[model samples]
Target chain A: MEENKKKSPYKNKAEKDALFEKEFMHLITPLYNFAYRLTFNEDDANDLVQETYLKAYRFFDSYEKGTNAKAWLFRILKNSFINEYRKNVKQPGKVDYQEVESYYNSDDIDEPITQDLRVDSVKDLIGDEVANALNSLDVDFRTIIILCDLEEFTYEEIAKILDIPIGTVRSRLHRARNILKEKLREYARNMGYNG
Target chain B: MIKTITHLIHRLIGKKEHSYCCKNCINDLYLVLDGEAEQKQEEELLKHIEKCEPCFTRYQIEKSVKEVIKYKIQHKQVPPQLIHSIKEKINGII
Candidate 1:
C-alpha cells in the first residue's frame, strides 16, 4: 500500500473503471462484513462502507492499479473507523491496544488457554454461539481474529493492514485465538457439551 | 511469574484436563496452524503431531476455532440501497 501510494494513477477513465469494477467493486461484500463487524450497527456500517468507497474512488490515484485492493480498502476503512467513528462509538468497554500489546508482549508463553476445549465441543458450536464469542472480545482482538481467521490474510498482509510488525502480528494472533477459544469453551460448557 | 500464577489458578479452579500440547509444541501448533511455520518447521510439526495425540488434538481444536468463526460469523446481506447509493455517489463524482 505504501508503495502503491507513490505510483501513478489510472491512465484514463476507462482504465479507472475497469480496475475499480474488477478489483474494488467485487469486494463490497467482504468490505461490508468487515465494516459491520467493526461498527456492529447496520446503518453505521453502511455509512462507513459507503464513505470508504467514496474515498477510495476519490483518491483512486494513490491506489496503483491491480494491487491488493482489498488490503488497501481495509486499511482505509480501519483508519476511518479509528478517526471518524471511534469517538462516536457508544459501546463501552473497548480498551485501546497499548495495554494489550504490552501485556501480551511480556509473556514468554504459558500453556495454551482452553486446554479442556475439545474437538467435539468445537463442532457442536454453531452460528451465533461462535459469533457471540467473537463479538464479546475486545475490538482489537476481534479485529485480529477477523483478519487472520475469517479474511485469511497472511501475517505480512495483516501487519500491513494493522501497521504493526510481523512478530507483533503473530503474537497478537496467538493471544487473540487463545482468548477466542477460551470463550468458545465456556459457551460450550454452558450449553452442556462436556467435550 | 504470571505463567506460574495462571497455571496455579487453573489447577485450583478445575481438575487439570490432560494437556496433549506441551510448551514446545505449542509454539509449533500456532506457527503450523497459521501457515507461518517455515517449510522445515511445518514438516517437523506434521511428523510430531502424527506421534503426539495431545498436540494433534490441540491443533484440531485451534483449527476448528478458526473454521467456526469463518463459517458462522456471517457477512450480512449488503443492503441494495447502500450499493445503489454508493454507485450513484461515485457516478456523480466522475
Candidate 2:
C-alpha cells in the first residue's frame, strides 16, 4: 500500500481545479497579507502570492483533504518566500568576512547592553505603533508574531508552517513578544500609561 | 551581604505559591495565556497565577498585546482588484 501510494500520480487538472477553488481560494487575503508583511512591498508581495498559488495548484494532489488546507497553503507560500524571494533579496549583498572579522577582533566593537524597564501596560499601544513594532522585527521573529498573534494560528500550526519544532516556536514566540513589547514600551510611556 | 541574606531568608521561608517571584512559573505564563498549554498544565499554571499578582499582570498585558495585533493587522482592507486578479491569474494558469 505504501509502495502504491509512493507511485501514485498527482491530481488531474479537473480535480486540481476543484480542490483549488474549494479548499484553497479563500486563503488569498491572509496569504497576501503575510506576503506583504514579509516583503514590505506591494509588487513583490503580489508576485509572491501569485507564485505561491501557482505552486499550490501544481502540487494539489499531495494535499490531504479535510485537514488544514490553510496550513498546507501557508507552508507552500512560506517555502516559496524562503527559496525564491528571500534568496533573490539577500543575494546581492556579499560582505567580506575578513574585514568584518578584523573589525570584531579589534577593540572597537562598542556594543552596549542596556535594559529599558520604563513602562507598563501595552494597553495604550495604538494601531500604527503595533504595525511599526511588528514591521521592525527581524523576519524570523516577525513571522512567528504574525502567525501566532495576527493570524491566530496555534503553536502546533506555526511549528508546522515554519518547519520548526514546537519548542523552538514557543521560545521564538517568547523572544518575539519580548522584542515587540520593548518596541512598544516607548509608545506606551508616551501615552502616559503608568500601569 | 544584603542580597545573600534576602536569598537565605526566602529559602528559609519556603517559596509560597502566592509569591509572584517565581521565574519558572512566569516563563510558562505565555503558553497558558495563549491556550497552548495542555489541560493539566493549564490548570496548574492558572492556579499559580491566581495566587501571583505579577504573573496575572503579565498575563493581562500579553493578552492585550495579542488582541491589539489581531485587531489591527486584520483590519487592513485587501484590495478587491488584487483578489480579482488573483482569481483571474489562477484561472488563466489551470
Give candidate 1 regions above 4 Å deviation.
Answer: A1-15, A90-94, A104-108, B1-24
Fraction of native Cα contacts kept in each candidate?
Answer: 0.73, 0.36
Candidate 1: share of reference interface contacts reproduced: 0.73
- Poorly placed runs, candidate 2 (over 4 Å): A1-15, A90-121, B1-20
lDDT of 2 at A137: 80
Specify the highest-lDDT model's number. Answer: 1
List lDDT for all candidates, in order: 0.80, 0.70
Interface RMSD of each: 2.1, 6.1
lDDT of 2 at A17: 67
TM-scores, each model vs. reference: 0.85, 0.77
**Among all candidates shown, the one with the greatest TM-score:** 1
lDDT of 1 at A63: 71
Candidate 2 pairs with clashing backbones: none
